[model samples]
Target: MNYRTHIVSDLSEIGQAGWDGLVRAQDKPNPFLSYAFLHALHESGSAAPQTGWQPQYLVLFDGEELAAALPLYVKDHSYGEYVFDWAWADAYQRHGLDYYPKLLSAIPFTPVSGPRLMARDAHARAALVDVLVATQQATEVSSTHLLFPPEEQARQLKEAGFLLRSGVQFHWLNGGYANFEEFLATLEQKKRKNIRAERRKVAQAGVTLRRVRGREATHADWVLFNRCYRNTYRAHHSTPYLNLDFFERIGRDMPDNILLVIAEREGRPIAASLVIHDETTLYGRYWGELEHVPCLHFEAAYYQPLEFCIEQKIAVFEGGAQGEHKMARGFLPTRTWSAHWLAHPSFADAVERFLERESGGIDDYLDELNERTPFRK
Candidate 1:
């Protein structure tokens, strides 16, 4: 098949329908890969050249029909990408090398694992991989990285000579439970009791949660959600990567995919957690609170989503990124992967070696996490 690659600075150039059509054709379609979610990141100014994430979205065309696409970026820093490469960047700096402006294909600020390459078939996918390497070589970027790609794509990337790095995230898998209590019954006695205690504490504090869908959420709800979202970053003394406009865009464009769990006390909202979902999985994305209510975070961020997943028959609830605490709430450790290719041959070789050792450590860590699973045998 003959394919031509076009690198555009904006997603709108490819148009939502065209881009999303390719995404849906993939084996695993995710909301994060949706045109609205990604375009919102750029159009809302949350991710752009000024913010160190310059869009360099790659699209492949077979005579004007969009064959494949990658949500690529020219990253000047590694802040939002959950896959930590700061040590690699530091090694580059020490050797008088530049790592900034590296090519990255990922959902900005989202650590949830999903498809990074949206292609129709194996032929198109293979062609897309070649285009990625050629783009890195042609642009002369220090390296290219694909974060949170599915396991199959990781294999293709490996075959294409990209180094594979492994990480872990906790996710709750539905076991055909009829309700939240039935799900809890699968957990060990201690973990099950602890979870009950936590929920009881929230209830005793007079904090009630209301799950609001995107379309049902009012403007005031979004404003408060944004405030809570910003407060989360502020508490850590870091700047927020997303803004109100981005949330509003997703709410309007993909209303069915958005769920806001609002925590209220005395009939006044004090906290919020935002979840994004597709037909199969619910993703716990962002959360914050105006008042410190004990166990509120777990309730809004974990349990509520877990209940929603069971009620809606969603297969998985990804607890997001790193959190050992999530294990106590029935989330089990799951492996996530990323692929990399450094332009410098020597450095690439070094990273390959490092990844081999790191891969073993991740394996051992996953083993340990599994041994400590909160669920009953």
Candidate 2:
């Protein structure tokens, strides 16, 4: 099979229909990899060159048919990517080297693990790995990083000479429970009791919660969510990577895949959590509040979304990034994978040794987390 590669700066270069067709063909089709979600990231300027997420998407064409593509980015700074590489950048600076213009492959502002390489078949997938390595060598970049790829894809990256790095995220798996209560019943009594108490705290505070599907969400609802989203970032003394335009674009383009869990006081919205879902999984993305109700964050962000997952028969709910606290709420620690390739030989050797040590730490961490399982044994 003759394969051609095009390093595009825009999704319009390949168009939605073609790109989406390949995403759907993958063994695991996810909403984050969809054209609707990614195109919105760039088109809304949330993940564009201006913000340091310059698109360098690699598309493989087999005689005019879009065979596969990787959502690549040229990042000047690492703000939205949850994978911590600041130490690597600092090390480069200490050596009087530059690391700002590194290459990254990930969904902007989302830490959920899913497909990064949206390929139609093994042939194209293999071709993509080769093209990416060749592209890395030809470019004047410090490193190329692939964050939150599946375990299989990470292994393939390893065979292609990329170093594999492991991390952990909390996720809730369905046990075929008929409802929320039934699901809660599987947890240890202490955990179950604590969760009940937390939910009650929100209710006793006179906060009422409701969910709004994207199609049914009003502009006012989005405005409220953006406020809450920005507030969360502000509280941490940081700027939000996404804006209202980005949320509204995803809402407009992929309404069926979105759900907003909002909390109200006296029929007025005060807090909200945004989650994205498909038939298989629900990804907890963002959340914030105007007033601090005890445990309101868990209610809006975790409990409500967990209930929605059970009701919809969704197989998994990724609780997003790092949160050991999520374990008490019935989430279990799950392993996430990323691959890295440093351009400098000395730096590459150093990182490879560092990753070796980091990998061992992650193994012990997972074992410890398993020993403290929240579920009844």
RMSD of 1: 1.0
Q: What is the per-residue lDDT of model 2 for residues 28-94, given as tens digits with 9 covering 90 to 100? A: 7789888899988888889999989999999899998998899899999989999999999999999
What lDDT score is found at residue 244 in candidate 2? 94
Residue-by-residue lDDT tens digits, candidate 1, 1-377:
78988999998898888888888888878898888998999999999888999998888999988998888999889999999999999999999999887999999999978788888887888899998887888886899999999998999999988999999998889998999999999999999999999999999999999999888988888899999999988998999999999989999999999999999999898999999998899999999888889899999988898899999999989989999988989888999999999989999999999999999999999999989979898
Candidate 1 error regions (>4 Å): none
For model 2, the stretches where C-alpha displacement exceeds 4 angstroms are none
- Where does candidate 2 clash, by residue pair? none
* Residue 204 CA displacement from its true place in model 1, Å: 0.9
Compute the lDDT of residue 182 as modeled in candidate 2.
98
How far in Å is the alpha carbon of 41 misplaced in model 2? 1.0
